[model samples]
Structure formats: structure tokens, C-alpha cells
Target: MVYQTDLDAVLDFPILIGDIGGTNARFAIVVDSYAEPREFPVLFTADFPTIDDAIQSVLDQTSLLPRSTVLAVAGPVDGDEIDLTNSDWVVRPKQMMKTFGFGDVIVLNDFEAQALAVVALGEAHLEKIGGGSAETVGSRVVLGPGTGLGVAGLVHAQHTWIPLPGEGGHIDLGPRTERDYEIFPHLERIEGRISAEQVLCGRGLVNLYRAIAAADGKEAPFSDPAEITSAGLERSNPLATETLDLFVTYLGRVAGDLGLIFMSQGGVFLTGGIVQKIVPALRNGVFRAAFEDKAPHRTLMAEIPVYVITHPMAAVCGLGAYARTPGRFGVETAGRRWRAR
Candidate 1:
């Protein structure tokens, strides 16, 4: 059901915007351009049977009729197909467009959209974690650890921001402490690979909990991450507290390494569910300690600003930005060359 492609002005087109994580899918109808959208509707995917159904429920939030949509999903989007890494939802882009009655559909990797959004954000939105201020427009890195660890980077060139995706989270994790060394073997016993995702994601915290508990010769406590976090912060469980400490330390190490590799002089933005779960811990743990631990170069790296995106719909804003310019990927260079005229 294709509409008139010649809608030149896009005046009445209410673009449906969304940020689809594995657990929730937030839907909104942008009455105007994405730069300054007004009305919004958010939803949880678990409450619906399919993505289509979720969108339908979102539409019911108001009388606004949507003509197009840009969905940001937390998973690999190759060709026209996408399968959420943490959920059972699978979608075909073309099919979704047809079903939703939209002439065109924009589907992007949620992290990629996040990288794009870094270009559009203003000062008031981002919360500074550590480090001083950001460079004007140098190389930057964005990382999120939710259901899994998502890695993406953006470089400025040709007056545009280009996002680069990487499977770096799956890279082998290395420990830098005596406690880490003890925990590493236990982690390896459980996951075998001990990938960054194993220690950096929501589940990764639980993994750290198990490993640390075992290292302390204690049995694995709870089955849920919330339980572990609760025990650590509220209940004051010794094992959970120690595990959270080590997890933050290792995360700092990984973030520090990533910063060096990317040479992110602009800044590094830390986001995702786990970080939100332990915001206070970030101030106390390895997040900055490990980040500034890079010897000799440590002082230089410390100059690089770091922030945590507190906005819940950050990725949605990113997806909305992606809908405006297509094919912004595939031409990024280490020297910061973007695919612009």
C-alpha cells in the first residue's frame, strides 16, 4: 500500500517513532519533524504478541494517524530482517511497512541510532559522569550494556556524523586485579568464553555475582539481577556488594581500553540498564579508576570527558534522526570521513 511518494512537504505525515529494546518497545507519533516532536506513546513488548500489535496499541494512545515510522531495535539488522537478541520478536521491514500502511519504513540497529543521536544532542540532556568537557567534534565512542553489551562509535567528517558498529563486546575479557583473577576462573567455568558481554550486560552482573560468590566460597544467591542489585544496595549482601564492586572495576577497564582504541577525545557516553541500576556505584567503583589507570597515557586519557545518558528515550531520538538521512553509514574512515557529497 504505497502512498504518493511526492508528498513533497511532509506536512501531514505523522511519523511513528520507536525505541525497541529487548524488553520494551516505546512508540510515539511525531506530529511534525523529528527535530522537535510533540506527542508520544510508550509501550512494553512483553505486553503484546507481536511488534505489529504493540504499534497498534500505541496508535490507540491517541487519535493521531501515522503515515511512516522509524523503529530503533536492539539487535543486528541485516537486509530486511531483525530478531531481538533478548526477545522472541522477529520482523521483516518490508512486511512491517506493508502491514503498518506506511509507504516507507526506517529500521536501524538501536546502537547505531544512538551513535547518530550523539550528533543531535545538546548540552542540557547529557549528565557528566567523570572527565571535564568534550572536544568540539572529535572522535567519540558510545556504549550501552542492557540485555547485552552494545558497541558503536561515531566520527566527524564532511560535516556529518557516521556511526560504526562492532562486535567488540564479544571480545574476550581480561581482569586486572587479584580479585578479578580469582573471579575469572569461576566465570570461565560458567561461560567458558568470559566475553565482555558476560560481565558487562545485565546478565553479566549476575555472572559476576556468581563468580565472586564462588571465589568467596559462597553459593550463588538469587536468580535475578534485580535481586542481586537489591541485595547489594538495599539488603547489603556482602557477596552482592563485592560482585558489584568487581563488575564496576572490570567495566572501567573495558571502557578505558575502548577509549584508547577509539582515541575518543570528544568523549565517551556510558548508558544502558545496568548502569542505571548502579548509578551511585559508578561514582565509587572502577568506572573511573580503571578508565584513568592507563599509565603514562593515563593523564591524557583522563582529559577525555565521559557522560551517562539519563534520558530513557535516547535511542528513540536517535532513530528519529536516522529517518531524516539515509545511507549515512558504509563510508566512515579512521581519519573521520563520512559519506557526504
Candidate 2:
């Protein structure tokens, strides 16, 4: 059952919306334009050999047969095969269409779906940190620190929102303080240099903890990020506590830089499991102070609102929105969209 349509055509319902990350794959089905997205239980990538197997498991449990799908992946969406950055599974949209008997498939970067969620989400779904009210009109940015760092920008134009996704997490990070200079040399480098992702992600938290321990000439014990986070938040270990402080500080600096670059007056959103877990630390003056530390544009930075996305299915909701009303968003589908011809 092949469906033919132009580049700007609205996707036919029912639609499968997915947010595929390194650790988990979340799926939802929207039966129609007016119907809410019915979410399925989260699936671990390791539990399934391929994405097809995961989807098949979900299909076995439900009666819904979606005609189209929009998948937000953790890696770059280019060519026919899309590989997840931190996972072993590879997504092939063309192959999916044949296997699932779908008409269309749209691929998006994970952060791009996050950017779309920023526009679709309401106040109830956001937790404010510090800063003035968001501007009624302007660009917005969303950053997530999870298995890896993800970044995207959203801009309103021609009465529609356009999401811009890029590899902003790989940007270089340099030390600015005496404390930073002491610990940075001990940080693990990707290719001889430490990027923002080196100290901002899940493994990055462990890296920060080890670096702090190494700088103090102590043996690091914890290997898991959760252990470090628990010790830091509880103040059970001095090294873990200091590591969390530096982690938030560096996150603030990076967020401030992105805020200035995009002039995100709409707001700057912080997503992923890591941000939500450290909300208490994020509001404890250190994060906000570092965000406002931009000398030349301190005033401008202060006016930009920052929020943490509280909704668990934000990316799936974003894809559902696009599936329901494709004309409302200016998503470029030239190469990313595949059809069963």
C-alpha cells in the first residue's frame, strides 16, 4: 500500500511517533488529528536486536496499525541508514516502510524533536529556574545532557516554527577559573581535547568525579553516574559534592553561550534525565549566577528565561504535533522523509 504525496503534504493517520535514545525507545500512536497519542511502555535498546523487533513487540500488544511514522533519533539523520550515537541499533526508514507496510517515515535528530517540544509544551510542563519572562516572539533553544549532549534551536518565521539541529555538544570547553585549571588536565579527552559533552553527560558526571578525585590526589571509588549523583546531592562525599558544583557551573556557561548565540528570547529549555534529577542544584544560585556571568551581555542574558521540561514524553508529543499538523511546522523533509514507491 504505497501512498504518494508532495514534500509539504500532511501525513496520513494513524501515525507512529517515536523518540529513540541511547538507553530507551519510546513510542506512541496517534489515531487521528483529534485523538491523543497513546503511549507504549518504554523499551530498552539492549532488549531488542533491532528497532523492527521493538516495534513488532509493541504491535503484538496493540491493535493500532499506523500508516506513517516520525522518528527522532539520537544521531544525525543523513542518507538511508541512521545510526544511533550511543547505541548498537541502526534505523533504516526505507526498510521500515517495507517491513511495517507504512506509507511514509520522517527522521529527525533527537534534539530537533526537543526543540519542537519547546513550542508545543505549556507552562505546566516547564519548571522555571531564573530570569525574566520569555519574549512573545523570538528564537528558542533546548539542551539535554543524558547519554550524550544534544542541542537544537527553534525559530518562528512565516507564521511557523522551524527547528534547527546540530552537533553543538562537541564544542570546545576551556577553563576560566583557578579551580577549573586544576581539574581540567585530569578530565578524559575524546581526541586530546575536552568538549562540553566530556563533563556534561551521564558518563561525563563520572568523568568529572574522577577528575576531581585525581586533582586532589585521591583514589576514585564510584564508577556509575547515579552513585556520584547520590553522594553529591546527599553531601556524603566531598569530592562528589564539588564535582556536581563544577558540573552545574560548566553547564551554566555553555547554556549562556548558546543563549547569546541564538538570542533565545522565547526561552532556553533544559531537558534529559540529568537536568530533571539535579533541579535542586540547578536552582541553588550557582547555575543562575554562572548563566548571568556574561560580562558584555549580562543584562540581556538575565532577561532570557530558562526552564526544565518536566514532561516525560516531550519528544513523542512533539512528533505527534507534526504528524497531526505538518503545515504548522517548517520541518525540512527533502532528504529525511522516505516513502514506499
Candidate 3:
């Protein structure tokens, strides 16, 4: 879908778009709307003590400073203080502006930015997971499991797009099967209270593996999600395979529930690093089955299209779009728009 926005408007100043997640921080510069975004080297979030450190590192290496910036963070955004849910990085927009002397700084929930990117995405950016055609006019939801589970929604109203961001990942995990029941108790005990994030993130992969192992009276020795995923995809380890299967199934169930809640007939997009790595597992029918398992609303669920965003610059595109036509995005910053310093 080609976004109907003017890219030239955003190029008046050197604009920096940062997609900061628990695992990685991706930076890009907006040269023109018709041109490809120039990206910086990927920075691991854990290596830096704070967001300021990471930004400074990028500045030091690139020898260029942005006149304005939009940072997409993996957490809730409220006021001037922002903290990442899965990483120990706190970002303060006011403090950052004082330190860097930028003209404007905008902070957004990572998935909120994802919601905006959904509109800017083209067919080449999306891969259909399941469902029939999208409703063309309604709500569209985007959720994904990565360093943590992120959820957001987008709706078109009065020829403008609005993004709804919330901590939907922290919702309670609902069990739907005998295996689910067996594992629920373990996850609850392990988390002190079982939230969806406890079992749907990178850490959640290991958590599921351990929970399944505990349920079957076996010991799970895996320490990393990558190790578990490798073992599962290869099918060399039965426990690992079961763990991945359970993860995909639960993901589908949660996605279905979200679709029904939002009535996301427009579409549901899965955006995250983890899903991109496990695309094969998502296509093996387990995910689709669980997604359509809504009893009375099976037909409604089938009508809601779902796709995975494969674009590396999804969130950046959203930030750039908002920069071009902030009013169309319905984002209120009290008239504080991006300007060259």
C-alpha cells in the first residue's frame, strides 16, 4: 500500500528515526520519501547503560547530528520520561533535548509506530499468515512477540489515521487445552502472576520449554531462546519442538482474542524480530488453527486478515510519515513540530 504523504516536507531538516527495542536499536536517516532510508549500524541495547549512551555512540561514529528525531521505544510513552519494558534504559525527552540541542524530539510506543507503519506498508512489506480479505474499512491491530510482546491498533477516521497504544502484552494468559492447564500453574508460579509477556517473549521461549519439561517430569537444560529455537526447528529434541509449538499456538490464540476485541476487520499485522526468524513455524497450520478457534465467531475471525511485516524500516517509515503530516496522524504534541536547529 503506497502511503499518500509528501516526503519532501520531511526533508527540510536532517531527521533521525530510531526504533529502540529491548534487543536492538535501529537508526535511519530520512533523505527523501522516494529514496531508501539510510540506516546506521545496529546497536545492541544491552551494551549501553542508557539510551543517551547509545545515541551518543551513533553520533560519535556518524559525525552527524539530526535537527529533529523520533524515537520508537519498546514501552509505554507518557510525558517526558520513557522507560523500556524489557531493558534497563530510561529515556527522558526533555533531558535529551537539553543535551543534544535538537529542535524537536518525539517519543512513541514501538507498536504505536508499528500501527502507523502499517498504513505506509506496501504489498512487498507484508506476508500473509492467514484469513480472508481484509474489510477495507475498520480497525487494524498489530501485535508481535520479540524481546517482549507488543500490541497496538490503528483506525482510519475522517481521512486521518490514529494509533492506539496500550500495554496489551501484560494481559492475563488464558488457557484453552489440557496442556495449557498443565503449564499455566508453572508459569504462574514462575512469574508470581502469569501475564502474556511471561510466555510470549524471547525469555518466554525458555519459560515455555521449562514449563513443558516440568509438566512431563523432565529437566530442561536450555538457557537461551536461540538454543531452544534451533533444537525445536531441527526436531532433534522433542521437548524443544513441543515448546515452540506451544508458543505459536498460544500466540495465535492471543492474536485471535485481540482481533475479536478490536474487530480488526481491516487486518492484523505481526511485527517483531522473533516472528521473522520463525516464519516457517508460523506457517505450519498450528498458528492458523489456534487463531480461528474462537467458537461462535469463527467466521468473523476468518474474515480478519493477518500478515507479518517483513520490512526492516517499518517503524522509521511511520515516524517519517508523522513528521510529514503530523495533523493527519492525529498525534498531539501541542504544535511542537520538527524543525531544523
Candidate 4:
């Protein structure tokens, strides 16, 4: 499938860049091509009845008018109306252009923004995991486990970066080890099938804990992922500890799979709140061991680098990069871009 599109579009100066997710919406204003984005405080989606209200709040606070906007939303960017995968807020680029009097409005998937950040972010913003040096010219993968699991690929062709976003998180995942077999049967299923998100997201941690507990015939006392993580990190609960180990192992496996699929010699980056929190767990040998267990391709996988994105505003930074120089990235804006009449 053709994943890249060539469209002649330029966002005017004083652009508004937003990274809208299920729980939080972050906004920033770029005064000019050379100016850095001035970010506003994050807003909870629950507090705002609609996306319009949220944008208005940011405008009121900033008191800076923007002629164009670039939004990174949590769901697919298809057609005029876009609905968030995990929230009630619906984003309509055409409506936004009309409401805000914008000359241009460009929308992209949240993970696509993450993939762009992989290119825009410097080494200081990334914490290295187990792997060799990243090749200068190869595809890259960025996946995050947060409110949900997001996956995207970044490719370099024609001297421009291309971000490929898809529902890779929903891909089927199965057990490969004896321990996995024992826990797989107990985990909850979506439509009677297990996907990567089933055990890789925030709620996925809780699911893993519960499944592990069920396998051991023990009562699970924790329902919140944070609680389980805290207990696991502190070594206060065995079940939580086991859950965390398995979670990291599975994450490594999935990252390795994507790395092989894209030949991501540039790197495989891990993003989101969960990854940042579990840096200690990821550094343990189990994660890397699982990642390199692909048998025949173990040597090749070992040579690819892995990193955790440490930037607090990765998506915002990505949008800022695109707004500053749209030609630097090959973004498909056929149905995702709106213009003033």
C-alpha cells in the first residue's frame, strides 16, 4: 500500500500545535518559523465538554492568535470528522478551521506524531536500552504503552522522513513459552481474542496482574496499574513482580518483531508514561533476552538499538517540527488537511 503522499501545503506563521489524547490535551503556539513553541498547561478531556471548548481555553490563556493549526489526535485521521479512540471528544478539521479562522488545519494520528518525534528528538531526549549503535540510514519504530498501545514506523526516502501509523497494537499476540501458556488462558480477551494492547497498556498491567493471580489461584487485591507497578517495583508483592517481568518481556518481544519487520536499524523507540516509569524493569536482562530470542535473526536483532523517549512533550515537539518545515516530512494529507474557503 502507498503510505506516503505528496501535497503542496504550508502552515502559515503563528501556528497552533496540539497533541490530543484520551486523558489529556496539550497545546502550544509557534509564533514564527524560527521561534520555539510556547506550550500551555495540559487540560483534562473530562473537564472540557467538547474539543472546541478546550481550544478556546488555550486561546484565552495564551491570548495569541494562530493562522494555522496541526493536531495529533489519538485515533485515525480519516474523513472530515475524527473521533478519539478512547474519549468522547470528536475532532473535525474543517469545523476547527471555521471556528478558529484558520488558513490551514492538518491532522495526523497520535503515534504518527510520535514517529515524527523520533526524527526531531535529539540524543539527549532518549534513554538507551540494550542494543548496538543505530544505523544512520534505516527505518525506525516508535511504540508506546499508555492509556492504549500505539505503534508507528518512520522511514527515510527521497531525503524526507515518512511516518507510517497503523493499528499495530491490535495485532494478534500468542503465547510462546510454557509460562505464557499458563497465563494466556486466564487473561481477558477482546472479542474472544488477545491483542498486543491486551497486555501492553496501562490497564494491560492490571490485566496481567489479575491473570497471573488467577493462574496461581490467588486473590488479586490491586485494581489500579500504578498500584501494581509500585508494589512490583518495591518488591512488596510477588504477583505484581511477576506481572511486571512478563509485561516487560512481552514488550521486548513485540518491539523486536517490529524491528525485524521494518529492519529498523535506525532504532526502536519506547514512549509513553508506562515506559518512563518502568525504566528499571526494562534495563533488566529479561527484556533484552526475550527481544533477542528470535532464533535465526538473533544476531541481527542484537545490532539494532532501543531507546525510551524522555521528552515530556514529544508529540508537541513533533508537530512543531512539521509546522516549522513541512517539506522535511512526507505526511499524507489527502483527506486529513483542511483549508479556508
TM-score of every candidate: 0.86, 0.97, 0.90, 0.97
**lDDT string, candidate 1, 179-295, tens digits:** 678878877433466788888888888888888878878888587888887777663788888777777777787888888888998898887767777778888646788888999
Give the runs in model 1 whose Cα sits over 4 Å from its true position. Answer: 1-12, 38-41, 188-191, 324-341
lDDT of 1 at 17: 74
Instruction: List, residue by residue over 158-196, the lDDT tens digit for candidate 3.
Output: 777878888999898877788888977666343367888
Write out the backbone clash pairs for model 3. 1-122
lDDT of each: 0.71, 0.90, 0.81, 0.90
Candidate 1, residue 257: the lDDT equals 81
Q: Could you give candidate 4's per-residue lDDT for residues 1-341 as a string of tens digits?
A: 34333347567889999999888899999998788789999999999999999999999987689999999999888788899998999998778877989998888999999999998889999999989999886899999998889999999998889899898999888999999999999999999999999999998899989999999899999999999888888888899999999999999999999999999999999998889998999998888898888889999989989999999899899989988888888888878878885
Worst 10 residues of 3 by lDDT: 1-10
Q: Cα RMSD (Å) per model? A: 5.5, 2.7, 3.7, 1.5
Cα error, residue 153 of model 2, in Å, equals 0.3
> Any idea how many clashes model 2 has?
0
Candidate 4 — what's its lDDT?
Answer: 0.90
Can you write out model 2's per-residue Cα lDDT over 213-328, one digit (the tens) per residue? 99999989999998888888888999889988999999999999999999999889999889988999999999999998999889999999999998998998888787777777
